[model samples]
Target: MLVGEHMTSPVITVEPHATVSQARKLMQDHDIRHLPVIEHARLIGIVARSDLNWPSAAKVPPDAMPVAEVMSGNVIAVTPRTTIENAASLMLANKIGALPVVDEEEHVVGILTAADILSVFLEVMGVGSGARRIEIRLPDRPGALAPAVQCIGSLGVNIVSVVSAREQDGWRSLVLRLATDDLEPVLTALADLGVEVVSTGEGDD
Candidate 1:
């Protein structure tokens, strides 16, 4: 998945000259934690809720303080076309909560956050609320997964997700999330193919 496909668009913004109190109101009204600061239609900085609680900042009422004083000017932003995984890595590396999605001319178009990444993670893991999960142990050979998948496919089971990872020695761990509740046919088919069924059960919500 790409950042553009999941990032929040038409982002709420605050001008650098805007008062900290105004920025706080925007965050409160929109229920957002991050505010990208714009200057002359260009993104110049970003501020988070925590940025408002500085000890020195408390001396001046927020209404009298310019947002630029507390906002971080070293803004780290991403593009819409950036891969979801890459965007996530960027967040981890920066130790920041959000990234502004920018256009070719550096125009802020959207924003992505760790919360959005969590939603993507749940979808990728096939936490389909009521789906069933099946784990199979297969060899790392190229054709190993094909036969097991073919077995489940032949039984008309809708595979919601198919992810594999290398295990000890030559083993490959296959996690299959299915749309069906019944696992008898799929289990039997895999058994017929001599595939080792590691585990099977209803998915946790």
Candidate 2:
């Protein structure tokens, strides 16, 4: 899915001149960890809760300092059209948990976070609540799926998800997720139809 579909829009931001205390309050009130820093309606930096923690030997209270002093000026951003996978890669490469979503003029529109990507991915994979998943190969011709799904339906098995991709031997491997913990019945039904079961496994929450 695209960033815009899942990004938190109308992001809560902090002004450059805003005190660190104010930033902290915003984070606490919103239950957010990252805060985009804006100056004159332009994104200037980003601040994280970890970035403002002060040591005991520090001369100044972190909260008393201007947010601009501790915020990271070299912020990374992604456009709303970016894909969730691509956004996740950027977060990994930058060693950050969140990225500011900016428009053509560099104005912040929304924010995407690692948590958001994780939630979205788990929902798509049908594994958010700890369902068992399996991957199997099927013939790449018409009528291949009709019989397999029909067999699954016969058992009242819920097909949580299915992803197919090209494979060797003119077959497609479909990764399927199910709400039921027991997989034997579904496996047996597919086997009865001469379906090749590649792999089966359980998933953790």
Candidate 3:
């Protein structure tokens, strides 16, 4: 998915001249951790709840200290069209909790937080879908997954979703969410096909 599809738009922002107390209030009111610092319609910096907790912040009066003093000027931002994967990579590489989405003119359009990414992950995993989850390990080769999937399909079990990841030692891990609760039949089918069954459980209701 794209960042535009998941990012929170109409984002809240703070100006550089805004007091630290004001920024803290904004975050508290919105129940948000990060705020993009804007100035003259441009993204100037970013501030987080953690930034407000800096030791220096305790030394100064929050009402008198400007957000610019604690805000991170070296900001990393993404665009609406940026892929969610790329944006996630940027967050991981920078060890940041949020990323501001900007347009070509560097105008703040939206924001992507760790919560948003986690939501996408849960969606992809079909969590809380009330389906039966089956995890299997397959050979890391073409056509390896098809037979297992087909075996489940042949049992008249509806597949809700399929997610895979590469593992070490030339094996691929697959997590399949099946629509039915009874996984015994599906498990037997896969076992009959010599597929390695990692685990099976029911998804959250």
Candidate 4:
């Protein structure tokens, strides 16, 4: 999915001249951890809850210190068109919890946080869907997954979701979420096709 689809819009922002005390109050009022610092309607910096707690912050009076002095000027940002995967990688590489989403004019539009990505992950994994999860290891060659899919389909089992990944040693991993809770029949069908079943369990309810 794209960042635009998941990012939180109508973002709450702070001006560079705003006091650190005001920034802290904004965070407390909105229950947010990050704030994009705006200057002349453009994104210039960003501040986080952790930034407010910096050791240097303790040396100054919050009411007298401007957020600009404590905010990170070297900000990392993303565009709405950016993919969720790429945004996630940026956060990981930078050790950041949030990213400011900007438009072509560099106007702050929205924000993406680690929480949003976690929600996407749970959705992709079919969590809380009351389905049966089956993980299998298969050969990397083409059509290797066809037999398992065909076997499950022939048995009238409805597949909810399917995820695949390449593994080491020319192996591929396939995870399937089935609508039905009865996995014994499906397991038997896959085993009959000589498929290697890695694990099976009930999906989160």
Candidate 5:
């Protein structure tokens, strides 16, 4: 997936001259942690919650200090077309929570944060999505997974996600999320194919 698909756009920004108090209030009212600072329609810096709390560096009252004083000037940003995976890598390498989406002209377009990435994680997990999830223990052989998958595919069930992991018992397990509300048919199909069903749960569990 791409950053543009998930990034929060119509970027909410604070002016470079805006006071720390204003930035804090804006973040609180909007329930956002980071605010991109803009000056003359240009991306200048970004101020985060910790920046407002670190008084030793700014050494001024929140109401008296400008956002530019506490903002991170060396902002790490991404383009709209960047993939979500690459953007996440940048965040991990930089140890930062947010990345501003910038245009070619250095104009701030949107913001990508850990919260946005988390939604994708939940989607991959199929949590609270009313999808049927199944786990099967496959033999440690090459053709094991293919037949198990073919069983579900023959039933015309759409697989939402699949992950394979080695268990402590020296067996490889395949976890699958299927885009279907009813588990009975998928379960029966897997059972007919001699696949083991580990756990099952409905939405909002």
Candidate 6:
């Protein structure tokens, strides 16, 4: 759940003095969208693919443009110890897809991206055909999970995901995503079976 666990390390970087053409080539060769700008081992800023594109009809020379000219100096970053939730929040707040992981000295160590978070979340939530996602809270007990799942199975609901976590003593909150459209009936059935259905919602339709 930590940023370090999902961050991409050994990140490719472009020097501030590097020409825009050079940066573009690097991005193309690597098939990446963003590049962290560095100078003398210090994180300076970031340059995106959109920053490099110029109208083909323009007569400006590529050498006249440098990464420092168009790079976004207001780069948002996170520390290695930061949690995935916090990192994702920062990205969401800043409206950015990627976040550079920096050390105490602002030296780039890695990159955390939306793709990474989505991948991990999907794995934790389980991904498959008819994959459904639901969120609820359940009581902690030895046979809590089996009966809860059985209730759904009885309703013909295919459970594609089931994530449970213990928070605030004895009561456990669960986020269940199932691969079915008829969630209301299943939820009512769960409630009827004495399973607390705190909240329910549908998945990617």
On lDDT, the candidate that comes out on top is: 4
TM-score of 2: 0.76
Estimate candidate 1's alpha-carbon lDDT, on a 0 to 1 scale: 0.88
Model 1 per-residue lDDT at 132:
86
Candidate 5 Cα lDDT to native: 0.86
* lDDT value, candidate 3, whole model: 0.91
Q: List the residue pairs that clash in candidate 6.
A: 130-179, 132-177, 132-178, 132-179, 133-177, 133-178, 134-176, 134-177
Candidate number with the higher lDDT (1 or 2): 2
lDDT of each: 0.88, 0.89, 0.91, 0.92, 0.86, 0.83
Candidate 5, clashing residue pairs?
Answer: none
Model 3 agreement with the true structure over 141-162: per-residue lDDT tens digits: 8888889888888888888889
lDDT of 6 by residue, 57-119 (tens): 857667777789889998988889999999889988888888988999999999888899998
Error of 6 at 31 (Å): 1.0
Ranking the candidates on lDDT from highest down gives 4, 3, 2, 1, 5, 6
Off by over 4 Å in 4: 54-59, 202-205
Judging by TM-score, tell me the better candidate of 1 and 5: 1
Superposed model 5: Cα runs more than 4 Å off: 54-59, 138-144, 164-172, 181-185, 191-196, 202-205
Model 3: per-residue Cα lDDT at residue 117: 96
Name the Cα RMSD for model 4: 2.2
lDDT of 2: 0.89
RMSD of each: 2.1, 4.2, 2.2, 2.2, 3.1, 6.5
Write down the worst ten-residue block by lDDT for model 5: 196-205
In model 3, the Cα lDDT at residue 54 comes to 48
Query: What is the C-alpha lDDT profile of model 2 across 14-119, one tens digit per residue?
Result: 9998888889888999999999999877899999999878777977786678999999999999999999999999999889999999998989999999999988
For 32-77, candidate 5 gives per-residue lDDT tens digits of: 9999999988898999998888546655778988989889999999
By TM-score, the candidates rank as: 3, 4, 1, 5, 2, 6
Per-residue lDDT tens digits for candidate 4, residues 95-166, read 999999999999999999999999988888887788888899999898887888888999898888888845
